[model samples]
Target: PVNRLDFGTSGLILFAKSAEIQAKLSKEIQEHRIERIYYAVVRGVPAAASGVISLPIANIDGNRRINEGGREAETFYRVIKAWQGYSLLEISLKTGRTHQIRIHLSYIGHPILGDLKYGVKSDFINRPALHAGKLDFQKSEFKIPELAAALPEDMAGLLEALQA
Candidate 1:
């Protein structure tokens, strides 16, 4: 696969037919040519409606956390909606490290809702409320048009309840 989603996260994934294609796609990803967009329902509204989270993440005992010596990770987030105590975010990544979104959101004090590893679990959803909503390959050599997936039922239901 050219890219993978975190275990419980849902969204578009890219797969290559051959090793050569995989290498080519991997290069595009490494060069930040592919656009990845995610939607997450987080626990609380951030003080700022939009901002960037630039932090380094390291894997320790299989868990991802912010560490000064870790690889550089950058996450950009914009608050799409805020209701009750929760906020919906549209997030993009500059660097795709393992668990980058989860760790960055948690570090910023607004962990993704139901993300037990990084934040408290919630009744609204069993797994982290994150979905890979869009992927744009326009900037790459592949010439594939942008692809998008609607939020899965679980996430859409969670949002409906929140909006109620």
Candidate 2:
């Protein structure tokens, strides 16, 4: 999950159907064959329509931190929709690490809408505004199905309010 799904980023997560599939899938992850699409609610609008975030990530003790000495992590983000002081985003991760998206977004001053750890002060929805909207995978002998999870109630409710 992208930096803790908080209490709201509930969506598709791929699980291997068998131990053999799990082993193969694990290997594919290292090769970067697994793809993930995330949607997020954020405060304020981003200046650019879309861009890439390249940052090194390392596990510092128990927390993930951005550092010069860590492994490379990349995130691709684009604004999907916006209203008032908020915007929806489509995020893709090139390299998966703990908290990669959250840390990267926060570093850029965007931070997910209700993320408490990174810094969002909203009491109405006090959790990271992220969801694993889609997943795609490739395998040689077998086909790993593409998956899509529906938006959670809170996020849906928020969107409903915004639309209304």
Which candidate has the highest TM-score of all?
1
Deviation in angstroms for 117 in model 1?
A: 0.3
Leading candidate by lDDT: 1
Write down the worst ten-residue block by lDDT for model 1: 115-124
lDDT of 2 at 34: 68
- Error at 61, model 1, angstroms: 3.4
What digit string (tens of lDDT, one per residue) describes model 1 on residues 26-128?
9888887888999999988999999999999998888779999889999999999998889999999899998899999999999998888997687879999
Model 1 regions more than 4 Å off: none
lDDT of 2 at 66: 86
List per-prediction Cα lDDT, in the order shown: 0.92, 0.76
Which pairs clash in the backbone of model 1? none
* Tens-digit lDDT string for candidate 2 (1-164): 21234344577755666787778766666566767789888777788989999999888887878899899999999998988877888998887777788889888878886787774756446567788887676543447577778888878776776557
